[model samples]
Target: MLPSGAFVLVVIATVILHCNGAPTNCTITLQQYTTIQIGWTQQQVTQFLGSPGIIVLEVGTAGSPYQMISVQYSALQSSSATASFLFMGGSLYTKSQAGIDAGVYTITSQQYTMIQAGWTRDQVTNLCGSPGSAISESGTGNTASVSVMYTVSGTPYASVSFTFTGGQITSMFEVGLSPPVNDKITLLQYQTVQIGWSQQQVTQFLGGPGIIVLEVGTAGSPYQMISVQYSGQQSSAATASFLFMGGSLYTKSQAGMDTGVYTITSQQYKTIQPGWTRDQVTSLCGSPGSAISESGTGNTASVSVMYTVSGTPYAFASFTFTGGQITSMFEVGLK
Candidate 1:
């Protein structure tokens, strides 16, 4: 039998070797092969870890090593993240210390963890560990004071922001850079269009604004390509412009230059119904189409309606509305 001191050392070594390094006692909803043991091959890993969320194979180079597996997990209906374990010299190592450090975490049954905005934060002691680190302060009046926050950076990395109300975490801000502009909007939100009925009518029926951008058809098929641009610089310029080809919203940069050139249908004097009321136009076109741009325009304010009346070159009619009123209406055909 091993001596007491020898046994203690062995325990310490095992803890150092296998511990994920996550916050002790914090539970991880997404488990990575709870029964993982030694001598398991890559194929065995698949059967064990659910075939990995994603697999990337690359040719090995002199400096670099062979391709490895990258596993990712996501809370239900939430964002996803990657945790890569490099297969260096045929041995697996957590890609970074963050992974190993975070791996040590264990959660209790009383507390719950949430992976919001791509970072995980649990409301528990191990989460903050001890006192939080301070990060700038703002606000005034009754709710004004210094604010302290905690940051956990490592594999399964996270940032836990605590908003204090009398030194309690009244609210939380899981800090991470805002997602890429294109990623912020969904495939549908990128295609949404809005039209307003009337100011009062809007209040009566449509309480608030929440619409998605959706592509109607394939590009180069007389369909207007619609997309959204999210630039921190244009926070105040929430405007939505339309490209006429097939009623698609034009996503342009602050310079008003087209970011999606190939997607935009080239045309001169593209009929625009900008600065129109929704009630007026919806009354004409049945219902104001979809308000696509809220910060910019086209939010329950207009619709990109395409109606080709029987005629040479197909007489195309377009209407713009605001507050249910026809702000602009026009038609054109191949001359």
Candidate 2:
């Protein structure tokens, strides 16, 4: 059953089930992920993620004196990605993620309760972990404002975030770290899976995002890779893993994804080479490929993107640009 004003979501992700229409697609990348921040409104997040999120949990009735909501953006294309957000009065209060830093976290639900205002950054780091993933920051010197998040990796996923003014904590937030969940995938559901499906499509078909089990390569890099595991029909011990490359289903031990469907063909990829202008590559490949990671400004700008093609021997192309010209390039999982 659903609370008032809440839409149905996921067959097995949580208690609610059934939906009125096709669920909104939530396909995200590493670069897009960084643009999100705490305090953003639901409309803002939906615009960035490409659709309104399914209202997973809503507390109190529509006009109740108190209200809160928890929403999720599932099975992202970014390496080792997972996003969970909480809102109060329709405004974001807390958010968490994995694979943004490519570093392991050990923060627990128990530790989250200890976080308090006026604590020094060092005290929180000693209790949680040093150098929590920097969510956002502004200003400089002693007046600086910064927010950091610490996550508990692996089972019972959880995390905590803190905001500081000057060098002292001002506010804190956290999410997840609850008990494990049932992914609700069966052999029959698995049969419907196909190569090259977007993460959102897989989630829609399978009924949930499953657990993010493996994160390879660094965050914000072309080499980054993420694998998600779901339960099998046989038993809890028998699980399934899906590897994603560039936000598309790359592998499940069946046929690989059709990267060429979204990116360039082998012939177009070859036409792009070192020293080629960004426009030239776009002309040759039809698109510049999805920008995975980028930095700098104006003439000093540097960007990195991925171009994947179907077929064998020549797939998975990565390109780096500086000053709008190709600076470096590489490939992944050549077969």
Candidate 3:
């Protein structure tokens, strides 16, 4: 009951299929297909794997102009052991093989959009491809963490960092752009005023202090301290204080008062730490309203700077110097 030419056609098809010179028992491994990647052109794929056994084209609708193509090849010398590659707009979109490891899978934009917190590390790797870097840290008693960072192509300032705890993502965030620098004084200029710097060197870096006072201790005693104050920017109600022992830089501090035009925040007040130099404090809170100095016998001296949060007075910061170095400092709020 077979058609007239069907028998002849069967013989011809069998010969064509078996004449490729491949052994019937041959097998292919997943590593052999890893050369394939997304965004490869049709010509590139053809050059890599030779001509495919089947080529299929899906016509586009009136609304969509781009067409899709599928190229299929038989692996392991068996027709059933096949691999399929999908292409869109003449570029490879995806590939899959039967009974062979595909290596690490790749993801599409749609898959990346679906990533969410509470996903396991394995799920993220399978859905978004391998990350560029993975960092792990150990915590106390069964607490350990990992962070995976991914850099997207063509984006210079944007990246993704995913934190994992106990094999599940604990947090995820996108980083874009660097923080802005707010340093009014340049580092090079600041470094010029190192410890033991002479008064002359200090003046060269920052001009003359707004106010200067010298305290003299008892004769034959090494008690001597110099206090200096610098005005801040015209718009800032902050002031800077510098203390010098034996004519060398010792300690410094800054205080800010509330001005009708400028107000100091609680965060700014917390930056004032003991032992900080005058320049370091001023850099944080700007300037102060006034600076004063006092001296006593036996080489004891102190410099105090007043700050106003508003146009009214608010706090006083004082630094005590001994043997030409800062020994103690404190701040007190006004009643």
Candidate with best TM-score: 2
Badly placed stretches (over 4 Å) of model 3 are 1-3, 6-29, 56-65, 77-79, 102-335
Cα lDDT, all candidates: 0.35, 0.62, 0.52
User: Using alpha carbons, what is the TM-score of model 3?
Assistant: 0.26
**Pick by TM-score: 1 or 2, better one:** 2
Query: In model 3, which range of ten residues has the least summed lDDT?
Result: 177-186
On residues 1-335, what C-alpha lDDT tens digit does candidate 2 reach at each position?
A: 68754553335343222112334364455456567766677679777777655566889766443578777554454524556667766666666555555555567655654555567788888987676876655544676777777777675556666777788776565555441355646655664676567777997887767655444443344454556666655465555667766566666631222122446665666566888888888887777675544444567666677777666545678888888999998776534
lDDT of 2 at 218: 36
Q: What is the lDDT of residue 196 in candidate 3?
A: 55
Candidate 3: C-alpha RMSD after superposition:
25.4
Model 1 lDDT tens row, 1-335: 88769988876654444323321211222344223322344455545544333333434553355644433333322233223433433334333112212233322111212211111223344554544443333333444433344444442344544444433344443433222333222223234332222222322332322111222233344443333223222342343322222333333212212122111111311533455455434444444343323323534433333334333444555554444555565657623
Report the number of the highest-lDDT candidate. Answer: 2
Q: Write the per-residue lDDT of candidate 3 for residues 1-335, one digit (tens) a residue.
A: 99999999887665456334333322343444556666777678766664443554465652342767776666654556666667777776666666344233333323434565567778888777674244223232234555666655555555666666676665555543121122123223342445556556776667543344223322122344555555444323454555667667676555442222323444565665666655555566676424343333344445454444554465545545444444666556633
Candidate 1 shows a clash count of 59
